[model samples]
Target: MNDAVHSIAAKSAAPLPKSAGVTGRTNDPARTMAEILKVATHEFADKGLAGARIDEIAAATRTSKRMIYYYFGSKEGLYIAVLEESYRRVRSIESELNLENLPPEEALRTLVGFTFDHHNGNQDYVRLVMSENMLRGQYIAQSKSIQALNVPAIRSIRDLYDRGVVEGVFRPGVDPIDIHANISALTFFNVSNQYTFSQIFKHQMQDPQVLAQRRANVIDVLVRYLRA
Candidate 1:
């Protein structure tokens, strides 16, 4: 297998964490960590790893720079943690999709639509990813855990494709990774380039009606691609 496949296979071997949804811990330190991650996520997404300051994040939260360093070790460490937590939260929300009960086509539609909605609503996630890509994924490379966190997302697509094939509703030999890339590309561009796109087209991309139309379009595209 190639590197991507091998990485996904290895990551898939491990089960997701039980508390992948949220921290699930209500204690002080847990709360503090959660708080730090929250502020840090926005800070990093807004200013990036190099541009974002630890003191800024600390001042924004009810925490100190000392506590920030104490919790995350360093600015880079905090940035990595934010990256991991951001992906974890998105994947966690995806895990709650409960796609098993839906028909194959409907499951694919739901997945695509959910992704569109997520990317549209969570601009921070998009910005963080855009910034990371801008830096050629330097911080992402430092976090091996990110690969594991993302594996479930690909596995879900693979499982859905397998089921769809078995049900004779989907074309055979469609690679799950390809499907993911397609879906991500479609949805990600809607958010990552919305500002520039809006300016170029002079369109109100954020309007609710426009979003609804785009959401439907995304679902239709993915469903068509997956359908047999």
Candidate 2:
């Protein structure tokens, strides 16, 4: 009986009904699960764990909470599932970039570009993750599998730093962990507090051209700071 478990159990008990006028029989449990997850992800992102309603999720997916529980076990479980899948998709995309093959400078540029694009394009994902972190990652750290997904991104960045140091392209003393934190902080800040940032700066950061220019500026700043 912790608050998290209690929340999950409450959601599990009250399931919603399916939508009307949608009569289709399909043996695509996988597709159904994916659809549910896609809707759930947005709900969780918009509301955070505490505020997200299972009924809302059900309505969005046109399914019942029982079905969600049947597939994912509980709301906590569903939240973790959404996060793991999201991380997997992002990691898969990062893996394909193959920064290891590029020269140090080019690899850094590509990596930064990808990070910028990811945060900008997937603002919901960014908000979801920031909310999780703000909660001290209590839910996310519970899953070992989810934690393991970060390894590839970490290793790739480390490799880039190593190569850069060897080639005299970057300052020799930068720690990979520190570098990663800086990059995340820079990219996440603009999106995470877009409203506040807009209020303070008196402009919309959501504009596509503005975001694109910011992305390039971030890459330039990082490159200049790291380069020897």
Candidate 3:
């Protein structure tokens, strides 16, 4: 009960480092928004907007319902934000690829492979997009941010297409939008219809072997279509 015991007690009672609370909420707005979006992304993707509950999302996040509303204005606003973040994440990763460094054919093939892998890995993103489309893009249409996010995606394709055409490796008059559509369609179908397709064909669509073969086939189809 003397100085030594008092020192030991004080030391034991002292707070830990800020990083010790790594998972705890902090004043960083970005982290808070990210935490909310991470939880909301799953909720919306699983249940869609109409079925997702604000209270449930708030419960899943470190933040509260009021905080969520404060950051996103409304449930619809939060839904749009989730969609925006989901798209942003995949597109951001795509932007990081050194596409310009690779040859045109390699770049396009790399892109197709990457897109196929990204869609499969991020099934939540695929579901979110499907839910948005099912609503005829009702919530997605509300966000001007998503369009801005997608512009660079199309620009990347256009640049790749232009380079390929100039190199005489790609056919002339290829549309970037069509290129995106083909790649997206091939990749998206794998995730979007995975359940139904698997059931219909009794095939294990989620198998790693199946995915690898499909990935190669998708790249081959795009490469063949683009080749001059």
Better of 2 and 3 by lDDT: 3
**Order of models, best lDDT first:** 3, 1, 2
TM-score attained by model 1: 0.86
Taking the candidates one at a time, how many backbone clashes does each contain?
0, 0, 0
lDDT of prediction 2: 0.80
- Local distance difference test scores for all models: 0.81, 0.80, 0.83
TM-score of 2: 0.87
**C-alpha lDDT of candidate 1 relative to the true structure:** 0.81
Q: What's the residue-level lDDT of 116 in candidate 1?
A: 93
**After best superposition, candidate 3 residue 140: deviation in angstroms?**
1.9
lDDT of 3 by residue, 31-76 (tens): 6667888999999999988899998988777567766665676788
TM-score per model over all chains: 0.86, 0.87, 0.87
Q: What is the lDDT of residue 24 in candidate 3?
A: 53
Q: What is every candidate's alpha-carbon RMSD to the true fold?
A: 8.1, 5.3, 11.2
- Top lDDT prediction, candidate number: 3
Per-residue lDDT tens digits for candidate 2, residues 142-216, read: 765666788888899899989999989998988888888888888887788889989999888989888888888
Stretches off by above 4 angstroms in model 1 are: 1-27
